[model samples]
Target: MKLYQLKAKQAFPISKKEAWDFLSDPKNLKVITPDHMGFNILSGADRPMFQGQIIQYVVKPFPGYSTKWVTEITHVKEGEYFVDEQRFGPYTLWHHKHFIKEIEGGVEMEDIIDYKIPFGILGQIAQPIIVKKQLQQIFNYRETKLNELFGKLEGHKNYLELKSI
Candidate 1:
């Protein structure tokens, strides 16, 4: 199977600690996610983020159908970055990394996601027509919601950029 990569970056007008506190807590994911996706966290919000943390959620990737996604926080470095890999989900492989850095004015948040679709040849066919576009829309919604939440940092044009690798 071929692995596809997506990278998204956004600068938030907030301190590194503030950004870490918000993003590290998986509970806040529902806040930033679009309502159309039906994203809901099944795990408790009180747990602290650490290696081996398991998070469960249900999302409607397509109309009238719900998919349960389970991911494990495989690696973490406080105030720096964290990695989450899918244990069970729609994709055959899902590895996502979130990075945060202290920039000039505020904190910069970046997300790198590597995923592979299932169904062999059919998956390849769907990647361009469906999966790619769907992922873009999801990230676009996230960027807008994040700007509304923390306000955007100065001097950045695009909130998120996606490309294959």
Candidate 2:
């Protein structure tokens, strides 16, 4: 199996607390995910995210319909960082580390994901184009979502709540 890894970092012009609150909220995943992907919260969004917390969603990258993906919060360190792993999803292995560092003006969020698709050689051939595109799209959508939600707070070191836009 070929190991696929992606690292992404984004600066949010909001307080560490605010960023943590919004990102930690299980419901916000659907809000940040690209609508075209058909991302929807399947469970436990009403509660705060913590270790062992599971969030479910459906994604349709193409026209055939949707597939369910579930991730569990395996590690959390308050306002600093978290790690989520796929419990049941469309992959052989999915392990993601989400880290948040407080910057001078706002917060920097970083994602390190290591995943492997099933299907052996076929996955290797297809991932170069499609899976990569989907990953980029997901992160791009997240950046857009952050700007839409906290654009006004850019460069602010502190915030009160993770209110929706």
Q: Pick the candidate with the highest TM-score.
A: 1
Model 2 — TM-score against the truth? Answer: 0.88
Error of 1 at 105 (Å): 0.4
lDDT of 1: 0.89
- Clash list (residue pairs), candidate 2: none
Report the backbone clash tally of model 1.
Answer: 0
Q: What is the C-alpha RMSD of each candidate to the true structure, in Å?
A: 1.3, 6.8
Candidate 1 structure quality by residue, lDDT tens digits, 7-87: 889998899999999999999889888798899888745598999999999999988999999999999999999999999
| Model 1 residue 81 lDDT score | 100
Q: Distance from true position, residue 120, model 2, in Å?
A: 0.6
Candidate 2: which stretches are off by over 4 Å?
152-165
